[model samples]
Target chain A: MPSNIIGWARLIAGVLGLSAVAYIAVTGNYLLTALGFAAIYVVFVAALNLFMGHAGQVSFGQNAFAAIGGYGSAILTANHGWPPMLAMLASALLAALVALVVGQATLRLRGHYLAMGTLALGLISYEIAVQWEQVTGGYMGISGIPPLSIGGFAAETDRQVFLVLALAAVLACWSVWRLRRSRFGRAMGAVAGSEEAAAALGVDVARTKVITFVAAAVYASVAGSLMAHAVGYISPEVFGLHMVVVGFTMLYVGGIGTTLGPLVGAFVIGMLPEVIRGFRDVQDLVYGVVLILILIRAPGGLAGAWRR
Target chain B: MPEATLLLQFLVTGAGTGCVYGLVAIGFCVIYNASGIVNFAQGSFVMLGGVVTYSLWHALHLPLAVAALGAIIVSVALGVLTDLLVVRPLWHRRATMFVMILATLAVQIVVERLTLIVVGDAPMSLPPILSRGPIHLGPIVLDTQVAFIFAVSLLLVAGLRLFFTRTATGRAMRACSIDRDAAALLGIPVSRLVAVGFALSAAIGAIAGILVTPTQYTAYNLGVPFAISGFIAAILGGFGNPFGAFLGGLMLGITQSLATVAFGAGTRNVFSLAVLLIFLLLRPQGLLGTAKT
Candidate 1:
């Protein structure tokens, strides 16, 4: 339970992730391509942990923010020809603004009401992405999105994208670690544990909760932007209720409260198909059954076992 | 058809859809009342009813009533299974509400995937319990299925009201909902009541599924949307109020229908969810329930 162990675990995870990318890039394996894409989700699951694990709110609607971020960047860069950097920044801001509005509106609802409200909000965002074809390009999605680049070097290949995604994931994890140790992060923990007590302790409960919500939103938006550039195409289908569940699963399976939990959760969930490669026909079924067992027996996640 | 008749047709369809949602919402309210948990897997119960009934009536060639009865029994068993498998273990651990919600969501995934593996991915449907036709009354043309749905929903609401107000078991459940410890002290078997609440909720969801599947084909993934819309309806009518859930469902159904007419089908979900968000902000107590103190 020592803090140094978590720090070491995170450092090891980062090193292993980079090595995996290097291995995949050298061997040119087809299967490892998924790991590259999964790097973005590592960022997402970590972001989700900030809200659900650190801040203590259950939101089934984080997919809405991803859609906002994904579509916002895709439209600006793909359609308006904005620079990828500018579009990414602009989309993250846009998604944050939307999150602010949504969080302000529904954060007052206690418990499951907030969960349902967020779910509804996510579905609404998805509807907008799908139906507002003039902007989102409908189901066909926006394609030929420019890749992320700096100066002379463009991330034109999967290896470069993976490296970029890895940096972002590391950055996200570092920031969350910093946040967890900050005064604001402690307030989030207090608010999550007990809103009334936090308020009595003068923590500005609503404001702290909203801040965490916005932070998570920005993380998701940034991840979404990366996803847009990586795939060079974006669609509403990419962000839906299904992704929301997947993101939640990653956080839970990893362990909810810890900084290293989301990373571990995302890695395990992302690589689950490879782990269950023999159950090709019933992969989804087996995955689901394992997930249920985990939730029932080891609700704390893999990290939970370690903590115990 | 005249504009008035066109409007009436839309309203009629909306009412039918609302009835289905209300039925599901009532299920949500029942479970919510018994346990503070908002069962996200309520939708799977709906799917179970529709799919099981379809297989029984069509594949096994059972009588419609027999198939429907069998489907209801399956739903009740699944409801009990859910409590045993997911809710009880977590409740014992004293996990947070968020954990319970995640657990139910996991259940949703497990149930949907298992059902898909067994049933295949193709959508299935059943013939209407009665002969399929539209009933014309002046300017309004109503599908017989819609009329049946409305009738059944109303009957359910009334029956549930009587059950809660007149029956001893129902009274015990109400007591359990108000205070589990107090009810237990009063010699009411709180755990048994919770199981009954879930089973009853599941049975109601199944009935709604059976009623609707004749028209709208049943599929594995259909439950989440049903759960969402039904939850919205329950919230709209005020959680834990069965009659309120019914009314909320009807209102949502009508609004969705009208919204579809105005903004197109794609915006239907957006319109309903938007309305729910607005309502939650404005009147969190819902239309029928007293304000939470």
Candidate 2:
């Protein structure tokens, strides 16, 4: 098959799959929640792809930024009566600041050390979310969060909320696509290829990694805030290590380096539980098996396979 | 309790758990030395050790010692399987470090899920191998279980020392860790040694699980915490040093126990994680490890 034909096929299939979900959500109520969550994850996975796939760095703790963004948004809006948009922006800034400090500290380390450091960062954030009862409400979580709104227009209904989230997801993907074509993106590719070579070629390896890490954190933070507004509830469990696992699954299954990989991967993986809802007890087992098979068989991921 | 005595009690308890952490850290060292792969599934072996033993004893009515032995065998087999089925293929293909990490993580999740399916999610425990009561030593009180942990750990450490120093295979394994290409050129069965390393680590993790499960409960979800703590211990001991890992584990365990007393139970993980971050930044070479070239 010609390469363009394969690309077209993927495009059509993605559009159709997304349209089917959108139609179901618009027509009925059952799938709305799942669709909303999937949209949020789309943003999350795309941002993760920027750091992991493009930048060629490992971070087991992107969820830390997400948690920061989430708790920031939740607290600011729920307690301080701030508007949702302002709260979301504040949360994103906070996550970016955190990513800056943490990235500078950790990105210097090579390979496993970097991975371990990031993992620790994430677990520590989770511990705080659970332990800080006064702010986070502990396991009970903060509830009654206001719905996302802009300029006095609030997304109150499920359909409206899903639409807004879908728009954000699309914006996230589009930005990632644009960024991939930019000079900075190419620099990230260089860093991923070989840090020493990239450094020798004047790539400022450390700065590129830290910048990308911060960008990814901002993406995760925005997604976190979106999740808070969409669900109207915030809890530590929502942004735990499991989120990292899920993000990885989506990134790998969808095609990590590819532009549309996050969307395709997030949609497929996000709805997988619903697809296998009947096998409740075996969901995680099935996920693990599927992930392993994908790694072995389609190492480049579904998107990468499609391109080939 | 007097302040000093309470502190002493906490230290004793911490040391007991620290022994298990040391064992787990040693397992990490073995695999890392043989192959560059960091098996995130290491904790799953520990979980299996306790959970499998409980099932064999409680559900199948096996003798306690037999159950424990059976659990170790099963865990070792799984470890071998992990290497053969998961790590080996990825190793052969020269999968990126990220892929390898993700693959091991998947293995961990699969093992945890399988354990949950087989044993259910409720926590399980083994009856104490030794007598039930705490042994009072003047002002300090020590649980018999803690004593057993120390005894087992000391024996294992001594045995490992002898093996490394006195055995042909152990020396070859060490050679491979020092220089894999050189060892391979010299006709060491590097791949097989990697499998053996996995098996050794699995055995150590299982023993730790069995020893510690009597004092606390074991559940399918406990694997990640143990994995995190063990990884910290590994880093603290310097990446690939077995003895360093042991010492690191003891330090981590005691610090965590003290943190629990000083702050609260929930902050224990926070303290350890803080220690991990601080150590990673300031002392990446670890306590006993020389700077990497």
Candidate 3:
């Protein structure tokens, strides 16, 4: 396919995909409930890719942002009786704010130190989510969340929610595409390729990294909102280390910088368990083994392979 | 307990726990010094050493000495595989130092969980090869923890010293750590020796695990604490110096014990974390490594 055709095809597929999801809502396939999960993870991987793939900052705290988003959205809609739209927006903004705070302290560190700083941030968030009982509902999670509806159309089934979530994911990918072509995105690329070299060229290296961090956090938060809406509940487990691994896997496997890579990664990982429902015991081991193999052969990720 | 008694008890505990941390931290220092990458899976190696030893000796009915030997050998294999599968690939790809760390984390998680699946979720216990009775003085009591802590940590450190100082391969490993290109030019097989560094680090992890298991027992949950504690201890000591790691580990033990008395035993982790947090925020280059990318 022509490069331009590939771009157009991706756009058309996204729109049509949303319509199909809407059709799934009308038909109500319980198995398609898994797609809601895939959509959520797609957003998650895109967020991580923005930081690690594009901006060259490796953060283990996408799960933190997801937690912030999950709790922020769930509490607002579940307890405060806010509209879903407002709750989602608030959660995204909250994640961005958190990103800002963490960025200020950690952006100074580089290489291994930076990874540790972010990992620490992730651990601290885990502590807070686990320890803070009243607001977060502690380990048990906040359940009985009301499903979101567009105007009069209430999401009575997982299909409806999946459709909406998928659209959000598409928008996330669109944003990734916009970023890949933008000057800011190019600057992020420059930073990732070489920070000192970018600094020598007088790029605002620190600012660029912090901004990318905030953007990635926002993306993760938005995805978390959709995830909260889909399950009609939010829990601290959704933001744990295992979830972090899932995000990392999707982002890395999706090939990092490629706009479409996360979509591929999310589908493979999200759908794999459901696809091969058997061998539940060995699935994680298998996934891990496959991921390691992929890393060894395709360190740049699946997108890296495609690019090559 | 009287204040003096508590202090002495804590000192013993610190020495015991500190000894284990120091051993693990020494491994971290060796690997970091050799290969500029902080192997986050160092804890997994420790856990693996313990778990494998537990399985080999108790479950598979192997002799304790044979089990320990098997554990050490397997751990060395893991270290070699980690290098081949994760570290060498990232290095080969010319990945940023940060990316290699990320890869290690990825590998660590995989290894840690695989240990859990294989060993089962419950903590593993083995009968001590040596006696583990507590000997109480008038006010202060000492147990196997205190008695063996020094014997294990210091002996390993001393043994490592002799190996490095006396043997050609050991000195070659040290030289390779300093400058791989120059070491290779000087006719040392840099890649082979660096892999050896990984093997030795794994062996240290295994030995430390074996020594500590009689007191704390072996569990999958130990990996995170081990990795973080070892890293922080190594960082405290200055990332490359084994002696520094020994001091750093003891200091952590002291802080943890003191913090336990002051803030409550439950807050001991909070104490360890707080110290590392302070270090990260202020003096990150550490006692040995010095701050540089």
Per DockQ, the best of the predicted structures is 2
CAPRI docking class of candidate 1:
medium
Task: Tell me the tens digit of each residue's lDDT in model 1 across A1-308.
Answer: 33787767856766886687678767767755567666788889888989988888878888888887788788888889888888889989998898898789888887888887887788778777877888888888999889998766888876677778878878888899899889999999999888999999999988998889999999999888888988889888789766776787777788888888877777778777776675433555555566667777888888886665
The C-alpha RMSD of each candidate to the native structure, in angstroms, is 3.1, 2.3, 3.4
Misplaced by over 4 Å in model 1 are A1-31, A278-287, B61-63
The global C-alpha lDDT for each of the candidates, from Candidate 1 onward, is 0.84, 0.89, 0.79
Query: What are the interface RMSDs of all the models?
Result: 2.3, 1.7, 2.6
Best by lDDT: 2
A1-308 per-residue lDDT for model 2 (tens digits): 33587778877887798689868777967777778788899999999999988888898898999998888999999999999999999999999999998888888888887877787788778888988899899988898899998887999988888889889989999998889789998899999999989999999988999999999999999999998888889898889877887888888899989988998888888888887885544867877888887887788888898777
**Stretch of 10 with least lDDT, candidate 2 chain B:** B125-134
Ranking 2 against 3 by lDDT, winner: 2
Supply DockQ values for each candidate.
Answer: 0.60, 0.64, 0.46
Ranking by lDDT: 2, 1, 3
For candidate 3, list the clashing residue pairs, or say none: B238-B287, B238-B288, B239-B289
TM-score of 3: 0.89
Q: Which runs in model 2 stand beyond 4 Å of their true positions?
A: A1-8, A11-15, A18-22, A25-29, A278-281
